[model samples]
Target chain A: MDKSTQGRLEAAVEALIFASDVPVAASRIVAVIGEVMAEPAPDADAITQAVESLNARYDAQGHVLRIRHWAGGYRMTTTAEMAPLLEVFLRRERRRKLTLPLMETLAILCYRQPASRPDVSHVRGVDADYALRKLLDIGLVDVVGRSEAVGRPLLYGTTQRFLEEFGLPDLDALPNLRGIEELLSDPSFSQEKARLFMLQGLSGATEAEQP
Target chain B: MYRVKLRDFDGPLDLLLFLIQREELDIFDIPIARITDEYLTHVRRMEAVDLDGVADFLLLAAYLISIKVRMLLPKPAPEASDQETEDPRLALVERLLEYRRYKEAAERLATIQELRAALYTRGSASAPARAEPQEVLINASVYHLIRALRRVLTEAPEAPALVIRARDCTVEQQQQFVIKALTVGRDLEFSRLIRGRNRIFVITTFLAILELIQRGLVVLVSTAFDDDFVLALGASGG
Candidate 1:
């Protein structure tokens, strides 16, 4: 490709990503450019290179926003440094933090997709009805389908926004589950695990308080 | 008796795990009889506080008692001798282990969520518009109803049941009272409606509000969280 064509492709990629209200997949970018240019679409590699150059250009220009690769696509977002400014401009309130109960319930559903409400409640050792309802309301979880297990309760799974909000590219990006097993087998399991469970805001004397 | 706050007890499994860790007991070989005794003691404390959701803890307590009984009775040896007899605590231990794993996972995910909080995105304004309507209408509507009732109940005078008297007002009568109260031109504050009333009257008034809401006789407008809701007569009610 000539230098002019390469520059045009780079500009096209930047423009396409900027104009998109949602994340623009590489293939979608290629398809749009191909249809408009009335020529063969650039390969995924070329598009990726174009995006990389576009980002470099943005960095050199000290642009406040840059393209972010999230959930298998690219979208434009302001720098993390600009968060406070943007928040003030938007008059945004502090988003509600997930309560410990909701986080526990979400983790169970995340690791155990297609799990029923009873399955989740049994694991958490609490009735997850309210937590599940809140998660559904917040769009972090959805009733993916009904389980084949007895009673055929509705199966819940993490939604796409869960990945997007968590900055995960996909479910595969989740931390290794084996970490928990390793932590459990450690000699100082109780202390370390209790400290990790700061979700409840109780750090010390957790064991001493038990009957 | 050591009193565990209701909020501190995450659930039965959380309490049970705490007990096991505190005693340094093996999960695989729980001392069923002793743990059951300790667990029931904790349940007694929980009952003292009148915890709202003790059903799951009670269920676990019952299971622990059953396991203790099974341990007391001699079990028949397996005929094949190939498989060791299943421990009665096996199911409970498995569940505890599973729950512990997920709790750890939740901790890990919380860290990730914290990191993600640093990353801001566009469309916060439009996002809630799409997601809020259904949840706000169905869930928040009922939640606000309960909250409003609680607020009004606080203003109500303490229950004076010591002075025995015949029931003066029925739910239907209270419903009529609400209708008459809101029949005036302006909307009424929930706290105002129940203020200075006795407990029975306050409860009946709340029930009346619920009944009116159910029959579309009144509309509840809560301008902000935990604020007194304005009860307006619905068009149908008018």
Candidate 2:
């Protein structure tokens, strides 16, 4: 690649990582930078190196920035040394400690919103009355409307803050857990099966998925 | 011997179920007079019960009182010809019976939550010191049970000994220290970040790096062909 073309690729990658609120995965960085620069960076290693060089330069210059891997992907961030800047940049306030059950309930509502409390309970293998009420109290889940079935159950949905906490933009952006929709519809997927589905779906494969 | 807040009670149905459990009464053949009296007493003791939730409890109460009233009136002018020989309480009896099943189911669900929680503590013990518990949590609907379990988790009578071999260091405390250091330094090297740290400290530092990156406070950049990833944060962090 020509010197100017390589320079353009570096600038584009820098912009993408900087603009991202969460880690920008290496593959994602490669795709976005490659498209913008319109030059073949060939091989994953080539892209990886360019990204690393940029990181070195930034560190040498003491630019309150860094990229670290989390949740199986790389992301950009302001160093902990400069975490105080968040006093101003934190638009979505952090919550009180999120207990495990609270987080799971939030996940169900987030992934299967426009869903009923009973429906959520079904998938979780428990009565969700208390959990649903808790979500309501926190304002993270709301009674969006009613379900289509009899009893016209009050349906629940996740708020935007729920998405922000996971650094997800929308429901569709959430990593898939296979058979989730079917499990909600039937509420009988055993805990073992659900766990396996999440592990599998996380690998970006949808094969052998049972409804 | 204990009083639970209305918020802690879940719902009126939940309160009613709690009373049943507390009294050890058979739900299939409820002692209507005793239960009705006790339920009203609890309601009088607390004023914040939701109106709609109360209405639901009251509707069932009304049905029970009516059944007793009808059972009291003799022969009702030959029963007005439409009433069946069956006890009027059958319908309500069926409702209480049905509702009890769901209550039992909810309780069973709570047990599952507790079991799941125990599993987490076990997993935490086996994991690398730096590994925090996974982010996937038990749902909030079952959080009450989790609360109960957390109470149990802390019940392990012995406190861990505080040793300075980095054994005294907790992940939370370390996360904060690393974040503070990075924030003040503006930028730091991967090796520089781990200086004079122990193995456990190294793991936590790595996790801190991951957490910071996840939060968008760290950025990793590279040249066209380098394996050495230089970690950077915003202009104020390294």
Candidate 3:
């Protein structure tokens, strides 16, 4: 990693991130740079440095777009100041919130995955087909594999996009699941504490999640 | 006419939760026969409105009815012990509790979705790169199309019942009509296509639009809910 080569690597990293519409992984960037330059692949640390340097440059230059690390990869996105304008330009409907049914289905999948549709339906006491299809269409939940249960139904799991979209670093970061026994112990749990907690939970989204 | 929009009907579990809250019923020990009657009453109202996606609710109603029937039946020899003979309501209660937990979590996720929607990305680069011809449409489902169809059908003037001959508009004929309409006037409004049409004509045209979408002849585009879709020439369209 000579001074000139280091500068070229940083430039290459920037160019790669800029060209990619999806997030670019550090390992993938290293492989591409190694293949293109016909040299040894740089380590992940080098790529991280390049990203940090690029961010610093963007900050110093007051550029609206910045390379963001999300879902274990880097992608270029505009600053929060630009979100309102970009949304207008994109003509995105902000009212496309996941309905309560869809959310309930997603929540079951999130905590109990990789679960079968039957499993989810059993717990929710309703047919999960429509909700599952909608979730699959939206790219939040995916058919991970077939379960080895009685009929070997398809197992569903949350995608990496789920983590990114939900502002969770990983499945481990999901809020702790309250014990069923604890909930069942209180007779008025569902109507009282659960309802209040859900209302309070609406404020779960945090500022750190902003791109 | 008590018209209910399809969006107004949440899942059956939601309706059950609402009924319990409204009736001020006990969660742990639900009065099955009473709740079933209330739930059926709600279902009857939805049926009157002719809601399309009420099958899920109907299925739950049937299940509740069965549970209510079981409650009427005598217990099996008092079972082995109280622990062995689990209360039937116990399972239903647990299911409701679990669903309630996830419903809350989903609301939390909804906040995240709103926040994520607020965060902006670079211009065209915000779009995901696709190896295949991506599902290049908004979150518009068949439900939206159906709702549009319902609205158009309802708005169309009532055809006289005494007509000697039925106005037969085949799907194939409607397909040709749609293509011709789009070719002559690109990006035509969906409502305009079905406006002033009879019930049969409106249905056939809706089917034709779906076929055109399938064949990549035209694409449906809308930026807002309940907004009329524009039928524009697709990539493969002439």
lDDT of 3 by residue, A105-192 (tens): 8988988999999999876666789789888987889999999998899999999888767655468777765555444445655546
Candidates ranked, most accurate by TM-score first: 1, 3, 2
Q: In model 3, how large is the Cα lDDT of residue B135? A: 27
> lDDT by residue for model 3 over B1-238, one digit each (tens)?
3223353445787789888978887775588998999999878766655556677788889889888877887777765566534556655665576667677677777776776655655544356432321222345444675688799888968878887788799999999999999889887898899999899998999999999999999898663547677888788997
Clashes of each: 0, 55, 0
Using TM-score as the measure, name the better of candidate 2 and candidate 3.
3
lDDT of 1 by residue, A1-211 (tens): 8898898899899888877767778999988889898556798889889988888888999988777777778877787787777667666564545767888999988887878999898888789998899899889999999988888889999987898777787887888664434544567456454344433322232333222
DockQ values, each candidate: 0.25, 0.01, 0.25
- Residue B183 in model 2: shift from native, Å? 85
Error of 2 at A177 (Å): 13
Question: Looking at model 2, how many pairs of residues clash?
Answer: 55
- Candidates 1 and 3 compared by TM-score, better number: 1
Q: For every candidate, what is the interface RMSD in angstroms?
A: 6.2, 14.8, 5.8
lDDT of each: 0.76, 0.56, 0.75
- TM-score per model over all chains: 0.65, 0.32, 0.60
